[model samples]
Each structure stands twice: as structure tokens, then as C-alpha cells.
Target: MTAHDTATAARVRALVAEELPRLVGIRRDLHMHPEIGYEEYRTSQVVVRELSDAGVAYAAGLAGGTGVLAHLPGEGARAVALRADMDALPIVERSGREWASRTPGRMHACGHDGHTAILIGTARVLARLAAERTLPHPITLVFQPAEEGGGGGKRMVDEGALDGRHFGPPVDRAFALHGWPDLPLGEVGTRRGAMMAASDRFEVHVSGTGAHAAWPHRSADPVVCAAAIVTALQSIVARNVDPLDAAVVSVTVMQAGEAMNVIPDRALLRGTYRSLSEETRSMLERRMTEVAEGVARAHGCTARCECIRGYPVTVNDDGAVAQFEQVARATLGDARVRTIAAPVMGGEDFAFFGPHASACYWALGLARPGIGCPALHAPDFDFADEALPTGVELMCRLALA
Candidate 1:
């Protein structure tokens, strides 16, 4: 690194160290009071308060009344945007931490608490740099709501969160990060192509005649038909989709008979399908409906399939990925950056930013050596406090890049 660059990196680190204490407090506060999608009122307040204290400009009460957009002005023509999700999952906290979620059936199991804290730190540090006039371009801060299936990222883009309507300039490129449990702490990872799968949900309703459990010939059992439909649905991935391609069809919810002895007149089946490519996604939807209907007909029942499209495939722009690698290595050191081996099957609403700007989403490592962390969305999962400084430093340097 050049002398100027080295000095700048050092300054950023020192600033992060200065801010860590308060940021950690804010993160713990968020963890203790978790909120679900479109309901992050308290979390939204924390973000706005932090931005206000830093003298950063922002707009609140957005994206279903919980989104916040903060900005920093610069000399560049178009702004660069950074984002963090502000929603928690619906799982009960079982992490056993002293600061575990106080609200029952809600927790920040996805490390969104950490992401929000890092972005807050980034805003604070960069606001200081902007005061010193060291900024290279306009920076956008997007605190989005409802990332856990509420389409808050899409809502933010639709509401002009990145278009500079409330900020410095129209955003040209965007970046986001998620805390990853598999990678060792202090590392950051990304790839040039697809980073996450496109998620789609399905519900199947099967209609059949009700009958007594003891009378086999007296009824057309809907439960049996629903089970058959579920079994045949698996073939959509195993037999229909190409082995080279990746697809998932899971029947997660099933409801039919309530009584032990009586067969219900109808059955309901709900599940999700995920694919990495649009072609595969389209095919999965088509074949899923076809399989359910085809299987139900042969079982003396009628079926209706409803497919709901969720988040699109998260694709990383080549140029954005390159810039992320460069800035991450420069800020965190060369060995701390990793090129991920493959795209994960999970879904991310951050994919919503792809159409508006050159967007890149990466992973922040959170696991300790020889001790694996809890999987995301698990009851025991919690954000790693020790990794906060690394996340903050990367985001701060990315803003200056």
C-alpha cells in the first residue's frame, strides 16, 4: 500500500476502535428488542438517531413506515450506496446470551443486528471523514426493513431510497453484506456471478370426498391424495430438473384431517421452490404445477396449485465484485478476502437492487476457529460481537473507495 493509503487505513481503524463501544451497545440493544419485517420502529429510531448525531442527512418512515435512508454528499457525479437489513426472524431466542431477545417468538437470528451496527459505524466514521473533506464520491446509506421475506429491499428501491431523491446523487453502484457462520472470523467473501437463489412459494389445495376411516370404499381420501402429491412434487427436482442445475422443492406445511378417525374433505399443502437461474426457476414453477395436478387427477381428487414468486436470483456485477475485493483486501489485508467456491441456496432480498444499479453482496465471516457457529435462523444463532470492528472497517473503506 502507498504511504497515503496506509495512513488512511490506519485512521479508519482508529476511528472504528473509538466507535466500537457505542456501536456494540446499540447492537445489543437491537438484539434485546427484536422486531419483524415492516415493524422495525425501534430499530429505525436507533438508525435515525445515530445518523442525526453524526450530522448525516436521512429520510425516515419509509418502506411500510420503518425504512430509513441516510446520505453523505461528495464530489462525484453519482453516489455509491451501502445497505443493511433491519428485520429479525420469528424464532424464539435460545442463544442463552444475557442480551437475548426479550420479545418472545422474535430474534435477530440472521445477524442483522450486527449488519445494522456496522452500517451505523460506517456512517459515523465517514461523516467524520467527510468533515475533513476526504470523501471521493457521494455515499448512500439504506437501512431497509423486512428482509426476512417481506420484500423491504424491493420496497426501498421502489420508494426511491437509492435514487438520490432524498440524498446526494443518483446511485451508480450499490453494496451489501451478510454475516456468514461458516467462514472464519475477520474474513470477507464474494463471487462474480450468482450469490443466492431465486425463491418462490407454492400452495396446493386438494379436494376429495370425506368418509369414515373404517370404510375404504366409501370415501376418496384427500390426505392420501395430498401425500401422493407431495411425493410426486419431489420428482420435479429429481427427475425433471437437470442434474447439472440446482433446484429445491420442499413441502413444509400440510393440513388435512383434524380428527383421528375421520378423513377430511380437502387438504392444503404449502412449500417453497428455489433455483439459481431464471430458466431453472421458470421450469420449476411450471413443472411443480403440472406434477401436482397430474398426480391429484390419478388419485380421484382435484387439485389447484398457486405459485407465488419471491426474491429473484442475487447476481453480483463483475465490476462491483472486483472493486469489493480490492477495497476489502486493502482495508482488511490480502489474506482476509476469500473467493467463495459456490453460490448458496438461500434467498436474499438484496437482489432487488440489481436492476437499479451495479450491486454487489458479500459475506462477513463470523465463525471462530475449531468452533462452528449456529446456522442462520436457528434458535441458538446470534451475531458475533467480536467481528463488529472488521465489518465496520470494510464498510468505512468501501465508502471512501
Candidate 2:
């Protein structure tokens, strides 16, 4: 690296250290006051206030009224987009932290608060660099809502978040980060191909004849049939999908009857299926429907399988991944930058931005397992505040890279 580059990085590190405390405070405030997808009014306001304070221009009230896009201009049209979801989960907080969610039945279980604070901190650092005329490219900060299950990234893309229509220059590449409980603190990692699976939900309804509890031969029990279908759904992934390929068919919710004494006329099953490729995704959907209906027919009951497609597979661009690794290795030592071996099964709506721009989603190390840090979506999971400086400095470096 050039002497000037080394000096600039030193400045960024110092700036990150300076911003850590305020960023942690922002993250905690967001955690305490949480909002669900498409309803991040207060979260959006916080982003707007921070950008305004930094003298950065932005366009707000986007994507069903809770998305914010901020810009830090540079010389050319080339730009890099940094994204952070602003929505919280419906789960109640159980993390015992002082800043636990104040809103009932709502919490930042997936570390979006940390992500937002990191981006806000990145914007702050970039703003300082831009003022000193040392930053390279224009930056677009995307504070999107509804990433849990709401496809907020798709909403942002549709509304021209990267098209330069609303604000900033047309985006050339996009990057997003998530706090990963699996990785040790101070490390970061991502894969080259698919980073996250495509998320889709399904509901299987079985209908049969109701009968009195006293009679064994009087009931066409849909409950029994639903049980068999659940067992059969696993075989689709086990026996049908290629052994080298990955797919999941989970029956997470099941409802039979209200009373134990009488057999009900109907039963309901609901859950999600995920895949890393479109071809595998289509095959899973098709086979699931066929299996559910065929199994129900064998049981002399009618069945309906409804599938709701969510986000697509999150694929990383080769160039973007390489750039990220290079910059990250320089910022953090080579030992801190890792190449993930496989794609994770979790789904991220950030996959929506892949087709529109060269996008790469990465994992920020939070804490080790068996520690206080819990898996995402769990009520006990809280974002590690100590990782703020690392996240902030890396994001700033990626944008300037």
C-alpha cells in the first residue's frame, strides 16, 4: 500500500475508535425502542437525524414509508452502497441486557441495530474523509426496513435506491454485513458463491370427516394423515435432492383439533423450505406439493399445499468478494479475514440487490458459542457492542476501496 493509503487507514481507525461509544449508544437506543418491518418510523428518524447532523444529503420516507437513502458525493459517477436493515423481530426480548427491548413482543433479535449503528458510524467516518478530500468513491447508505420476512431490500430496489433516481450516483456495487454468532470476535468471513439460501414458506391443509371419539371406524382422521405427511416431507430432502446439494423442508407449525375427545374435520400444517439455487428451489416446491397431495389421497383425505415465495438466493459477485477480502486483509490482519467454506442455510432479503448491482454479503464476528451470544432470531440473542469499532472501520474501508 502507498504511504498515503496507510496514513488514511490510520485516520479511519482513529475515527472508528472515536465513534465507537456514540455508535454503541445508538445501537442500544435502537434495541430498547424496536420497530417491526415497514413500521420503523422512529428508526428512520434516527438515521435522518444522524445524516443531517453529518451534513450528508438523504431522501427518506421511502419503501412503504420507512426506508432512508443517504449520499456522500465524490468526483465521478462510481459509487458503493452500504446496507443495513432497520426492522426488528416479533420475538420478545429475553437477553437480560440493560438495553433490552422496551416494546412488548418485539426485539432486535437479529442484530440489525448493530448493523445500522455500524453503517451510521461508517457514514460519519466517510463524511469526515470527504471533507478532507481523501475518500475515493461516492457512498450510498441504505437503511432499509422489513428484512426479517418483509423483503424490504426488494422494496428499496423497486423504489430506485441504487438507480440514482432518488439520490446519489448510480451504484456500481453493494455490500452488507450481518453479526454472526458462529465466528469468534474480531473476525470476518464470507463465501464466493451463494452466501444465504432462498426463503419460502408453505402451508399444508388436510381435510377429512369428523367423528365421535368413541368410534374407531367412524373417523377419517386428518391428524394422522398430517403426521404422515410431515414424516414424508423429510424424505424429499433426504432421498430426492442430490446428496451434494442442500435443501430443507421443515414443518414447524401444526394444528389438529381444539378438543382431545373429538376428531376434527380438518388439520393445518405450516413451515418454511429453503434452498441455495433456483433449480433446487423449484424442485423442492414441486415435490413437496406432490408428496402432500399423494399422501393425503392414500389416507382417503383431501390436501392442499400452498407455498409463498420470499427472497431469492444471496449470490456474491466474484469481483466484489475479492475486493472485500483484499481490503479486509489490509485493515485487519490476514488471520482476521477468512474464506467461508460453505453457504449457510439462513436467508437474507439483501439477495434482492444482487441482480441490480455487484453485491457481496459478509459475516461480522460477534462472539463464541457457549457464551452469552445466542443464535439469531432467538429471544436471548443480543448484538455484541464491542464489535462496533471493527464493523465501522471495515465498512468505511470497503466503501473507500
Model 1, which residues run further than 4 Å from truth? 1-3
Q: Going through the candidates in order, what is the number of backbone clashes in each?
A: 0, 0
Give the Å error, residue 14, model 1. Answer: 1.9
For residues 222-315, write the lDDT of model 2, one tens digit per residue: 9989999999999999998999989999999999988878988899999999999999999999999999999999988989999999989999
The Cα error of candidate 2 at residue 10, in Å, is: 1.8
TM-score of each: 0.96, 0.95
Lowest lDDT sum, 10 consecutive residues, model 1, at 128-137
lDDT per residue (tens digit) for residues 1-401 in model 1: 78877888888899899999999999999999999999999999999999999999999999999999998888879999999999999998999999999999999999999999999999999998778765888999999999999999999999998787887889989999999999999999999989999988999999999998898578888899999999989888889889988889999999998889998889999999999999999898888888888888888888999999999999999999999999998777899999998999899999999989998999999998888789999999989988999999998887778
* lDDT (0 to 1) per candidate: 0.92, 0.92
Where is model 2 more than 4 Å wrong at Cα? Answer: 213-219, 368-372
Clashing pairs in 2: none
Residue pairs with colliding backbones in model 1 are none
